[model samples]
Target: MTAGFALSPTALGDGFRIESFTEVGSTNQVALERAGQGDPGKIWLVTGHQTGGRGRRGRPWDGRPGNLAATLLLRPKVELATAASLGFVAALGLRDALQAVMPSRSVSIVPDGGDLRGGGRFALKWPNDVLADGAKVSGILLETAQGGRDGLAVAIGIGVNVVDHPRDTPYPATDLSAMGAGCSASDLFFALSDAFVDNLRLWQDGRGMSAVRDKWLQGATGLGSQIAVDLGGRIVRGVFETIDSDCHLVVRGQDGEETRIAAGDVHFGAVASARNFKAEAR
Candidate 1:
C-alpha cells in the first residue's frame, strides 16, 4: 500500500477496488474493461506476475508476479494531454519510496545525464519512458478513452523492473535486483498511490501539470541529448530537445529545424558525441 491508497478492503475508496491475482493477460487490459463499466477511480489490478507485460509503442516489458504490474482505472477531470505527466509523478514517487528503504544505495540524479535527479531534473521521453544514466530504468504507457471532453478515461500503466533488467530486449534495461534494490510491492504500491493522489489533485487544479512539467525537465534523462524517433516505418533523427506539457516531443535536427513528433519508438545513445548528432539509440 502506498501512503494514501490501500490494497485491501478497508482502504478501498468510493468505487476503487484492488484486484490481486496470480497471473493475467495484462492489468491494463483488465482495468480498461472495468473502466468502461463505470468503475470509479483507484481500481487497481495486481497479479503475482504479468506473463505478457507491455510498454508504449507496443514494446514488451516482461514482469514477474512480485513486481509492480499494477494499473489504475480512472475517469479524471483532467485533459487528455495532461494525463501523460502522471507517469513522471508516479516515477518520482516510486524513486522516493525506494530511497526510504534503501538509503545507502547511491540513488543519485543527474540532469545532464548519468544519474537520477532526486529533486526532479530528469527529462521525459514522450509517451512514456524515464531516462536515468542515459539508459531506461523505468517506462510508462498511458492509454486514453479518445473522445473529446469525456474523451480520455485513462489507464496509466507503469512498469518498473524491480528485480532484473531485460536480456530479451534490444534496448538496455536494468532491474532493482541488479541495482541491489529491495522493496515490497505493497510498500511501493502505497507510495505510488500517495504520489498519484497528491499529484492528481494538482492535475485537477490545472497547476499539477505545470509542476509536473518542471519536475519532468529536472528528472529528465534525455533533454538536449541527441536521439531518434521511429514512427510507423519512417525514422527521424535529431537532438532530442523538449517535451511540451501536452507531451509533444520536439527533436531538433542539425539542419537547425525542430520536428514535433506525436508518437514513436525513442532511442538514446550511450556516447555523447556518437548520440548527440542524429543517431538511433536503441
Candidate 2:
C-alpha cells in the first residue's frame, strides 16, 4: 500500500489545484475526463499508485507505490502545433528539478553496443523522456481536450521513478533510490511543480520557444550522433541534427540530404531494441 499524497493547494502555487489519490486508473485519464467536462485547468491529478498508467505510444507505465503518477491540466491559449512544444518545456522542467535534487550525479547515455556520452547521470532524450545512465528514469505524456470557451486544455502527464524502476525494460532503468538519491516523491513533485512554473515563465506561453529549444539541446542526449528514427512504416538512419524552429527534428543523412521528421520514434546508434523513441501516444 502507498501513502496518500500530502499535497495542498497552497503548496501548488496560484492557479493550481491538486487532486490526490492513493490509486487511480491513470492520472491523465482523470484529467482528460475533467477537461472534457470543462475543468478550468491548472489542476494536478496525482496518485500514489496507478492501476492503469500509460506512457507515450500506449506503453505500459506502472507506478509503484512510491513513484510519481501525476498529470498537470493546462488550458494554455495556443494552437495544437504550439501546444505540442510544451513537451519540450516539461522536459526542461524535469531536468531542472532532477538536477536540483541530484546535483552531483553524472548522467550518461550508453545505448546497447553504443558509445557512451559524457555528462551528468541525468539527460533529456529527444521529444519526451528523461534518461539516467542511458536507462529511462522519467516518462512524459501530453494530452489535449477542448475547454468550453477557455480554449484547449492540455494534460501533461509525467512519471518519475523515485523509489523503484522496471527492470525488464528494453533499455536499462534506474530509480533515485538505486542511484543513491534518497528523496521522497512528494519532495520531487514539489520541486517539479516549481521548476515547471519557472520554465513556463521563461517560455512566455510559447512565444519564447527559441529559449526552450536552446536549453533542451544543451542537455539533450545523442545530439550530433548517428541515430535511427522509426517512422512507423519506414525507418530513417542519419546523424541526429538540431531541432528546427517549428520543433521538427532535422536529421542529416550521409548523402547530405536532410529529413525533417514531424513525428517518429528515435533510437541512437543502430536500432537494437524496441522503445518509445519520439512518437506520441494517440
Candidate 1: tens digits of C-alpha lDDT, residues 132-201: 3334566677777753434457787776666555676555556555655566566666656655565555
Which consecutive 10 residues in model 2 have the weakest lDDT in total? 273-282
What lDDT does each candidate get?
0.60, 0.79
lDDT of 2 at 139: 89
* Candidate 2 Cα outliers beyond 4 Å, as residue runs: 1-12, 116-119, 270-282
lDDT of 2 by residue, 1-282 (tens): 445454444446566778888789899999999988878888888876877899877788978888988899998888888999989898888888888888846534555444545335677777887887777889899988777687898999999999998887766788988988878787787778778887888788889999988888787778777877777757777887888887788999989999998787777754523344333211
In order, what is each prediction's RMSD in angstroms?
A: 4.8, 3.6
Q: Name the best candidate (by lDDT).
A: 2
Error of 2 at 70 (Å): 0.8
**Candidate 2, TM-score vs. the true structure?**
0.90
* Regions of candidate 1 where Cα sits further than 4 Å from its true position: 1-17, 99-125, 131-134, 146-152, 205-207, 270-282
Let me know the TM-score candidate 1 reaches against the reference structure. Answer: 0.76
